[model samples]
Target: MSITSAINLFRQLTVDESQVAHQGQPHVVNETCLDLLLIEMVQVLRTSVAETSFAVPHGGLPPSDSLELPQSSESTTARSNEEQERATELLYYKVERVGFRIGQRLAERYAKDRPRFTDTLDIVKFICKDIWIKLFHKQVDNLKTNHRGVYILQDNKFRWLLRMSGSEGVAHATQQAAPYLWFPCGVIRGILANLGVDSTVSVKETNLPQCAFQIKINRAV
Candidate 1:
C-alpha cells in the first residue's frame, strides 16, 4: 500500500485525542491539527513561508482615494507574539519526528519494489520521485546536483504548504509558514538516514507553496 493510503487509514481509525487521552497516554499517530492554538500557529507559519515577516505594513496609511484598504493584523501583544514564536519551534521538532518516522517506513517499503542501489544517486532519485510521489502524490518538480554529493529537489506545489491559507503581508506570511515546513524537511532527512546516507538537510521556500530541499551528503555507507 502507498504511504498516503496508510496515513489516511490511520486517520480514519484513530480516536479523538480527548478519548484517547482518557484511555491512557495519548500518542498522536495521525496528521491532525488538534489544538486551536496550533491551528492558528500553522496558519501563521504558513504565512511566514510566503513572506519574510509576520505582518506587512502600508508605507504610511492607504490613501483616501483607494477603493478599499487591505486589512492587516500585524500588531500583536508581546506575550502572544512570543508564544506563537515558541510554538512554531515546537511544531518543527514535533513534525520532524513524525516525518522522520514516515520517511524511514516509506524507504523500507519502497526498497522492496526495486533492486538494491549501487550508488547514493539512485536512492536520492527514488526520494525525488518515488518517495515524494508516495508522500505528496506528486513527484519533485525539479532536481539538480553539483556532482559532489549535493542534491537539490524542488517541489512547485508542496502538499502541506498548499493546505495553509495565505495571511496578510508577504514577510509575516512567509515567516509563519516557514516553521511548519520542518515536517517535510525532516521527512527528507529521515529518508536519507534510513538509506545509510549521512547528510545535512535543509529547506528554503522561494514562494508560497513552493519549496526546495537541499541534501549535502556527509558519508554514505
Candidate 2:
C-alpha cells in the first residue's frame, strides 16, 4: 500500500488525538515518518521486481584465462571491496535524496512555530528530541557527539524494525531492513541540508531492534 493510503487508513481507524496517543506510547505514523515509510516501500518493491526480472540464467562459467585478473588475490579483494562500497554509497544517496526533499517541505511548515537556532548543535538537538518525538512518539534513546561535527543517534526500539524477524540471518534481515532505513537516512540528510548543514547520513544495525545512525557534517572549505 502507498504510504499516503496507509496513513489515511490509520487516520480512519483512530477517532481523535487521544486514540493517536496514550499516557506514554509512540504513534505508529506521524506526518513525515509515514511519508518516509511509503517512499521506502515503493523503492523496495521496485528493486525486488527488477532484480527478479534480471536474474542471470544458469550457464557455464567464463574461461579462467579469458577473464582479466587484478594481479593478485589481495588486489582483487580490494577492488571488489571498493565496488561494494561504491554501490552501498550510491544506494544511500538515492535514499537520502528522497528524505532531503521531505525534510525541506517539513522544515518550511516546522519553522512556522519554532524559534531560530543559535548553532548547528541546536538544530541537531531539535532533530533528536522534538522532531524525533513527532516521528517516533519518543525522543531518541541517546545522542552522542564527537565535538568535531560527527554525531551518533541511537534508537533502541526503532519503530520500523520492531516487526522485523531475525530468523533469516543478519544478511537477509539487513536486506529486509534497508529500504525502511534508507528513507529516514534521507530525511535526516534533508533536514540538515534545509537547516544549512551539508552532511552525510548512514545506518548501522548493531543488533536486531537496535540501530544507530551516524550523521557527519561536511563543511565547505
Candidate 3:
C-alpha cells in the first residue's frame, strides 16, 4: 500500500489520542541511539567471529602437521580465504538472528490492536506502511510484487545508510555497507514469521543509501 493510502487507513482505524494517552505516554528515544547500537553490534559481532575463527582447538596445541613443515604459500592463502569466508558468514548469521528476535518482538507489540490480516498481500502492505514508518519514520519508496510470491521493497533514502559513507570507491563502500543490511533482512523475515508467513528476505545495494529488499515467500514444506 502507498503511504498516502496507509495514512488514510490508519486515521480510520486509530483510536483517539486522549484515550491512548490514558493508557500511558508513548515511549521515545534518541534515534541516534539505535544507529550507534547497530554500529557497535556489527563491530562486536565481527570481533567475536574473528576470534572464534582463529581460536586453536585441543587446548591451544598446534596440529601435528604444523610442527612438521610450513604450509605452502598457496595452501596458506587458501586456508586464510576459507577462514575469512566462514567468518563473514558467521557474522551475518549472528546479526540477522538478533534482528529476527527484534522483529518478532516488535511485531507482537505493533500487531496487538490490529485486526487479523486477511492475506499475504495484506500483511506485506502492513510492513510497507506501518512497520516501515514505525522503524524508519517513512514508508517504503516503492513496493513491487510479481503477483506470485515475490515482493520487492525499495527505499531511496534508507535511514540507516543516510549518514554512512566510504572513503573508497562506490564498490568498496557498497561492500562495506552490505553487512548492515543483514540485520534488517532478518527483521523482515522475523516480522513475516510472526505474521504467519514463511519467507526469505535478501537485500541488494547498487547505490549508496538506495537499496532494494526482495522477499520471496517459501511455499515448499
**Runs off by more than 4 Å, candidate 2:** 1-45, 48-91
TM-score of each: 0.60, 0.65, 0.85
Each model's lDDT comes to 0.65, 0.68, 0.78
lDDT of 1 by residue, 96-201 (tens): 6655766676676667658888898998999988777655557899999999999999988876666565568656766667656666677688888898888777
lDDT of 2 at 10: 31
Regions of model 1 farther than 4 Å from truth: 1-91
RMSD of 1: 12.5
- The worst-scoring run of ten residues by lDDT in candidate 2 lies at 52-61
The better candidate by lDDT, 2 or 3, is 3
lDDT of 2 at 21: 52
Worst 10 residues of 1 by lDDT: 52-61
Model 2, residue 42: C-alpha shift (Å): 4.3
Model 3 Cα lDDT, one tens digit per residue, 110-219: 78789999898988899999889888878999999998999999999998888788898878888898888998898889889999999999995447889999999999
In what order do the candidates fall by lDDT, top score first?
A: 3, 2, 1
Q: How do the residues 1-221 of candidate 2 rate in per-residue lDDT, one tens digit apiece?
A: 54444434333321234444564553444455554556555576556434533342112344334566436888667855754565555555655565667766555545546788888889889888866776677999999999899999999988767777668797788676775687778778878888888998888555667899999999889
- Full ranking by TM-score: 3, 2, 1
Clashing pairs in 3: none
